[model samples]
Target chain A: AQSVTQLDSHVSVSEGTPVLLRCNYSSSYSPSLFWYVQHPNKGLQLLLKYTSAATLVKGINGFEAEFKKSETSFHLTKPSAHMSDAAEYFCVATKGRDDKIIFGKGTRLHILP
Target chain B: SQTIHQWPATLVQPVGSPLSLECTVEGTSNPNLYWYRQAAGRGLQLLFYSVGIGQISSEVPQNLSASRPQDRQFILSSKKLLLSDSGFYLCAWSASRDSPLHFGNGTRLTVT
Candidate 1:
């Protein structure tokens, strides 16, 4: 079984400030993790993914995440938040070569100008 | 280059009415397809997934059903809609089990 846990349900960041969204996962085998963002009334977009490659993965729109095997955590972060970054973010995980992708409860990011 | 398409961007129907949401993938063959429902303030919930034609695996028991009539076409259906089914329905496709999923612009389902 594979599952993900988003530590925060909501996060607020001011424009030009740093942002962080914490996530953790549990899996019986090596895990494939991902970060997706959903804008209002829009589809989910893949921000980045970790497939047992580099622990620190860079994604689109100046976002990045680090996968810590020891801690079982993959946390998303950005140096400066933008207005367009305000959206619902999801942490997803799946065990090696499994079609079952488990999703976290999601964290709503609010960007303040 | 691959793309996923979902129809009926928004739909509002009364309870007990039937529901159908169509999803298709282009430029990819034998891709893994999935249907996910997201509710307000809640996360995404996987409803079904298919690896090939006529092979669908349901994750949860609900009033809805899924079908993969063709290699690239997946459909979500329900004989009777329920208010509890109101949410955002997303269609996604992946090249393989460990590949990243590409999602379509979801369909907004509102069952009143």
Candidate 2:
């Protein structure tokens, strides 16, 4: 089964500081990984996705994630945090192109002003 | 551009009431539709998915059911509402299994 685990349930960072949200995935086959963000009472928005392409994937709102096969990790990162970036982040994994996707318990990001 | 719309952004209903939540996608054809429920800490739970009209696949056995009446329409229904059913329901669609999903704003259902 393909699954994703978010390391932190909540993360707090000062404005303009770098942010990191760790995620680890387990899959039997080549996986397609994704990062999604959801605001309060809102639907999820896809931040980025990683197929078999480049390990480093850039996304909207200055977010990025690197797929590490050896580490079984796909950690989301930002060079600096903004108040608008505060939201719930989720890590998702799928076995292949045509497979059911599994979501991780979210990581709520708090930006301290 | 593809857009997904879900009706009744927020709903409050008494227990045992019949429930119906509708979703539709525009600017796309033969898209894959999905229904998901989000609880406080359980993450996004996929309830059902449809590959085409009249084809629905359930991922979890629950009091809820889904139907795809049209190529771009997905409806979630329940004969009787339960308190446990109170959660955020989201509708989503994707061009294919490999494509990223586009989600509707979600409906906040509160069963009283």
Taken in order, the candidates have interface RMSDs of 1.4, 1.5
Residue-level lDDT tens digits of model 2 in B34-98? 99999877689999999999999999999999999899999999999999999999999988887
Q: Itemize residue pairs with steric clashes in candidate 1.
A: none
Q: Which candidate should be chosen as best, given DockQ against the real structure?
A: 1
For candidate 1, lDDT tens digit of each residue in A12-106? 99999999999999876668899999999999999999988799999999999999988999999999999999999999887656547788999
Clashes of each: 0, 0
Against the true structure, candidate 1 has what lDDT?
A: 0.93
Clashing pairs in 2: none
Q: Name the docking class for model 2.
A: medium
Error of 1 at A19 (Å): 0.7
**Superposition error at B61 for model 2 (Å):** 1.2
